[model samples]
Target: MPFQHPKETGYGHVIERYVTRKDSDHPRYLELGSRRVLRPGWPHAERFTRHLIDDAAAITDVELEALLAYEWRSRLTAAWLIGVDQRTSFRERIGDLLLASEVCYSGGGYCFALARLGTHADAEILTAYLDRYLPRTDLRYDQPEALGALLRLDAHLGTQHADRFTEPDGLWDQWVQALAHLQDSPDYTPAEQRRWTDLHCDFASGWARP
Candidate 1:
């Protein structure tokens, strides 16, 4: 699918009012913490990560739902909050956003949230995403993260939900092929490349990355 930036929010709409907002001068935790996670040697990254997790866990369900109803940044943070709190109530909404892929940069957050939810129903949502979107290799979207989440859940739950996709010439192959193009794109950067692998680790560990 082609990229489409979301349109509707008014110009100068205040983002700081959202629970996902960082201090007025600081970057959102997802943006800064993700970079720090990829480069663990960064000073104070671990401490910051701990704070981020605590803050996420503290967000109320009403605040979280409001975040989900906003743009990618808010949605991403909201998903992380739900995952951190194991708020299963938002599983369906997060799954719907993952499948919708309505906005950019939030799909990984949705996948991670589902992985943290850690239930058969969560696995079903991840599997449905893979079944529907993995065939479209042209769109990199969040297929890899979704697959990684499902596989991790399968390992922990002792199920084979990912077996069908991992077989030779299956969805896994499509995902790999998609990655090659993503890597080859001129806009791709080392940080961007590492982000995917970092997300895999985050999924496996339920966003507890250091």
Candidate 2:
């Protein structure tokens, strides 16, 4: 039988086609096969997440929360789809979701994603989690990557409610501390700095007085 459009037959058939591929050893075949499933309107992204959650696969509760907390539109949509399918309590589960996303995923992009989500009503729990997570000096706070993620979160969400750690406290101070941590490291590329600076400056200038 020929593969039908999602509208013609729904998403289950599409998933079945993707999962049944026998040529797992062929990279090009696998890539094309994956793309075939992920094409713009297939709707399997949500279906996959929901399947994973419902089956209670090896994925941990924290991992599930992280998947839900992902900032990418596609990923978030998938997470929402999963939440809808499971009929889980989003408000009750939001804190864990945010924490899992923040802790498990690294990179400025993830931070920005979390910040965007933070603007929502469910994000207050996320903000509270950060307050508790960032202050533990005993933990690995010295890493520039960790600091960068914090800076990105603060950059997007603003730093008013959280307690200050770096001296000369305020948003600027937090950013500077993050920058300084990255300064001596060779791995800290200029492009990353430029990106962070652009976001930081744009945000800072928005509130500047005439």
User: Compared with the true structure, what per-residue lDDT tens digits does model 1 show for residues 1-210?
Assistant: 442222232312324543335542355645533534555465655554566677666666666665677778777766766776678999999999999999888888898788888899999999999899988877778876787788777877899988898787676665665677664453333233335544544633554645
Give the TM-scores of the predictions, in the order they appear.
0.74, 0.32
Cα lDDT of model 2 overall?
Answer: 0.37
At residue 166, candidate 2 shows an lDDT of 33
Task: Determine the C-alpha RMSD for candidate 1 after optimal superposition of all C-alphas.
Answer: 6.1
By summed lDDT, the worst window of 10 consecutive residues in model 1 runs over 3-12
lDDT of each: 0.68, 0.37
Question: Pick by TM-score: which candidate is best?
Answer: 1
- Model 2 compared with the native: what TM-score? 0.32
- With a 3 Å backbone cut-off (N, CA, C), the pairs that clash in candidate 1 are none
After superposing candidate 2 on the true structure, give the runs of residues whose Cα lies further than 4 Å from its correct spot: 1-94, 100-103, 106-110, 118-123, 141-159, 162-210
| Model 2 pairs in collision | none
Name the lDDT value of residue 31 in candidate 2: 27
lDDT of 2 by residue, 48-147 (tens): 4344334332333444444344333323333322332332334444434445444332322233233334343333444454465545433432222333
